[model samples]
Target: MATTNTTTPRPGGRSARVQAAVHQAASDLMALRGRAALTVPLIAARAGVTPSTIYRRWGELSDLLADVAVERMRPDSEPADTGSVAGDLIAWAEQYRDEMSSEVGVGMMLDVLSSRNGVSVEGRLPVPCQCAAFTASQIRTIVERGVERGEPVPVIDTVMDTVVSPIIFRSLFGSAPITSAHTQTLVAACMKTARLLAPVEL
Candidate 1:
């Protein structure tokens, strides 16, 4: 007896596929030309879809761009829990450096965040917000773990603002390149600081 593999596309599958294609095209365009150069017609052409299709789905070029930026800046994988805070933080920092150094990742983030000097066309910087949330979540997890182990919950905000933010800002501003060495240094510094701040259990 032969068994047939029967799987049908869900009702929203086509629209989802189209949305993903549109996002991909927008990301590529942003990487190549920046957000200011993106347009609905260009994205449609790149995605091999109609402008009407894009407009119908996203309503506006800015909306499409925002979604694409969010998708690109969002973490593709969760940070690993290596049972050592320093190791985990170094891994995360490396990932962050890799993402911020990419044309697509950095371009999309700056575009979405700096639109109109903090006034994005979408009325919110979804890309930056998502990225920050992910980072914060990871930091929170590490801090909680350290606290549970009778280690100090270091001031995460300061470390993020000082070390991590600089890498992202420099990369986005084209002021400097974020090399692996820089990331390693930042991670090491943060870890040392955390160790210094480690709380003693009573």
Candidate 2:
């Protein structure tokens, strides 16, 4: 008689711990050393896991880097809608900058870009698969709110190009402070343009 294999796996066990540790190590190394310098031995040494374990599980440098990138992302999609488009926009922009400015955050983008050459790191990249659905939901919520408020909503790509990308570039690459004043100015400019492009009610 042939029997089908039935095994229910439980998460949050030792394997989970090892994954987390290794992931954190990868982020740390990318941030401190530089993404181009990463290697399996280096990650294993930092993570305290055997190099073979990493090799067996990830198989390739790009795979592990991509996995760590996703793990480092915010668990929630966008922040809560603040009931107003400007309010929501500013809040989201500030939060996005703050997150990216952190040491780990800086490295996150580097690893992402380094791993995928020829892909524009210009504020447009594939959303990590795990968070893709959640991020979509968040954008929908923000857009729906704009519609209700009778506000002129810029396309999501526009926001990324104008608001998100600039701030992230400043935080990650530039020397200037990503201060509140700087981000506020950005928000104001985008909001003004959005209003200008919006249709006037008769």
Candidate 3:
């Protein structure tokens, strides 16, 4: 299951400020007191909002934590451009593996997944795997660059299944290390699949 966005409407003015404060409180509490110590009332007290505000906006503590994780994991910049499709894929894959396998990364992933079956806050759109959306967006950028350079690029699903999915699976479930070598191996497999998919001249 992909991580989905349970993005609510981003109202401006006081509402945005309140939302930011609430998210910050949740993040701080998670870091300071840990997940086992958190509750909606505790977060609301820290954020200077009533518990009702939180219930009205996020529905559950898990959903709020997921929202925070999604925001924290959002890419701050475009993927590194390494001048070739293979270089780009390897660089991106290696970094992806490193980040997702880290302690912070694992926490974020679990937070997002914990909310998978939870209810959306009132007036919020149901999350449709925002976590995978983030991954897909980056892959699309890389594929577009490959196309502009006349390089054969695997379709998004191919890249997701061949490269990203394995990395995620190993990071979350497998006890095996997700090494740089392993990432490059996955990228190589994805590129091989792309080559097979490319049309050949008669």
Task: Choose the strongest candidate by TM-score.
Answer: 3
Candidate 1 lDDT over residue span 78-137, tens digit each: 567777777767777777777667776666666566544335576875454655765665
User: How many clashing residue pairs, candidate 2?
Assistant: 0
Reference-based lDDT, residue 163, model 1: 62
Model 2 vs. true fold: TM: 0.63
Clashes of 3: 6
Better of 1 and 2 by TM-score: 1
Using TM-score as the measure, what is the rank order of every candidate, best first? 3, 1, 2
Which is the winner by lDDT between candidate 1 and candidate 3? 3
**lDDT of each structure?**
0.66, 0.66, 0.78
Pairs of residues at least 3 apart in sequence or in different chains that clash in candidate 2: none
> What's the C-alpha lDDT at position 134 in model 1?
58
How many pairs of residues collide in each model?
A: 1, 0, 6
Candidate 2 per-residue lDDT, tens place, 60-143, comes to: 788788667755563434455788878887876777667777766766656656554314557555554333333334544555
